[model samples]
Target: MNLPLNRRLFMVGAAAIAVSGPAFANTTHIVEMLNRHPDNKKLRNVFSPSVLKVQPGDTITFMPTDKGHNSVSIDGMMPKGASGWKGKNSKEVSVTLDLPGIYGYKCQPHYGLGMVGVIIVEGEGMGGNLDAAKDVKQRGKAKAAFVDHWDQIKAQGLLTPPAEQ
Candidate 1:
């Protein structure tokens, strides 16, 4: 059957949306950081499943397998700040990403070693062109603003040290 061009386009669009529905669910994705490194510091890596793409309202759980390892959001997508810690020995850190933008994150202590990751919140025409590491650098300045407030955070006890190594 020869369908009209508009109808065909509609069908294709609908199919694409259906196939990518799971990526937009308001759920959480857990990413762990293994505490394995020659220096006993957290390895400079995003741990398992490096690439994580989730929809708005979804949460990403960062769990440190070793002590002294933590994940900090270098992008403004997280409400807290550019840097937040999930102590090496602490439980999982759950972040509900409710905005529609690309978010970059990394482990502060290990950032110099290139340990980084990204989260792209599904929204109008923002998909299909995401570079995890690049996003972190682009948002570097905004992240710095948040990092400046670290002292206040520490006083609040929001910063938890990793477990005893």
Candidate 2:
């Protein structure tokens, strides 16, 4: 069948838009919980690959390789419009990231020892809440651990400071 040139062009443009539109499928990242890592850090029970970079709409699954651990967001580290979440101790939990920013989380049971993790989400012109993320008040080893991870993020240029962006 011979179709008009205009109709063919319109159909092609529609198809391209559909293919390049916002992604509905979510990517999942796996994080393992380890105990007594032997590396000598805060919070003996730890989350492997402590820092992860992902795009908006991705998901992260925290699996308890050892018993008695759960993932929870820090008090002031999430984006402006993002909400806090926590998983039940010893249970596997998957969190879907909808906002663009730096998310700092920790294991409730071992927060003092510094069982913490970070997730950096990059989106289209996404201005992250860097100041809020930096203000997360942690105690003892947890504070030190967060500092170390934050430094790495800055050094690696994974995400730019909101002020500078």
Candidate 3:
């Protein structure tokens, strides 16, 4: 038996909606970090775009163009029991963040030089107030330290000095 035109159209519409729904639902943002400094040998950290704000379910792509650079979350600074990742030799790693909070992370060997960064995860009904999250103090301090020594860091050739510090 042949189906009616209306029924066939409804099925087509349903299939189209099902196929396109996931595409629109999952959106990922790519954040790239480069080891673009001579003195980066001292600290393997994210020099450019050090701070990132992303929504839940978004992905941050950490690309290290140079060797001896990795991205990892730290305990107390990130979600509980977080740890750093091993260096990726010219590879891209994608991190999908789902929690809504302030996440602090650093390179294992370079945590001393403040090779640290923050991920402000914005949640629903939060009104983009990522600073309201817990552990803001520690994350803020780390961010400030990184910013404070940015000049010296660039001078040391660990990062490409932007037009303005």
Candidate 4:
């Protein structure tokens, strides 16, 4: 059957919209949990790129290059409606982040030495989790180191750059 040109264009546009949706634009980022800092021995046992900033619906894969580390979210550092996650010890875990906020995470066994990481999800604004993460009452050496990491993240405009080669 033959159709008018206008009708054909409308049908094609509608089909295109149906095929391309928000999910098609989501991205996946890879992060490594390393056993040592390449340049600083004192920084041994850390997340390669200790900080990350991503859009909502993005996924992050936390892969442990070291034998004894895990990525676990800080108790209070999630958006109001966001749920937290904890990867299996020393294993690779992929998480699809649907909420927009700041997330602070740490290695369960190495929190003291500051084996920590932070993530920020862009939303309406920086979420309410930042203060909570800062006031977490951290213990051991991490108490001071965590603060330093947070300050650095803020100084760099809230994005942790990829580790230097």
Models 1 onward score TM values of 0.50, 0.77, 0.56, 0.79
Of candidates 4 and 3, the better by TM-score: 4
lDDT of each: 0.55, 0.83, 0.55, 0.81
What tens-digit string does per-residue lDDT give for candidate 4 at 1-165? 499999999999988877787545788888888888866766788887788888889999998787899999888777787788999898999888888788888889898888888888876656466777788888887787678778887788754433568
Per-residue lDDT, model 4, residue 51, is 80
Sliding window of 10 residues with minimal summed lDDT for model 2:
36-45
* Candidate 2 ranges with C-alpha deviation above 4 Å: 1-25, 36-43, 124-127, 161-165
- The lDDT, on a scale of 0 to 1, for candidate 1 is 0.55
* Candidate 3 colliding pairs: none
lDDT of 4 at 127: 49
Which lDDT value does model 2 have at 132? 72
Candidate 2 — which pairs collide? Answer: 42-113, 43-113
List candidate 1 stretches off by more than 4 Å: 1-25, 36-44, 75-91, 125-165
The list of candidate 3 runs beyond 4 A from truth reads 22-24, 37-48, 79-91, 125-165
Q: Judged by lDDT relative to the true structure, which candidate is superior, 2 or 4?
A: 2
Residues 53-132 of candidate 2 have per-residue lDDT tens digits of: 88788989998888999999987888878888889999999998889888999999898988899998886434357777
For 7-71, candidate 3 gives per-residue lDDT tens digits of: 99999999899888864565666555555444455434554556666766777777665556566
Error of 3 at 93 (Å): 3.2
Ranking, lDDT, top scorer first: 2, 4, 3, 1
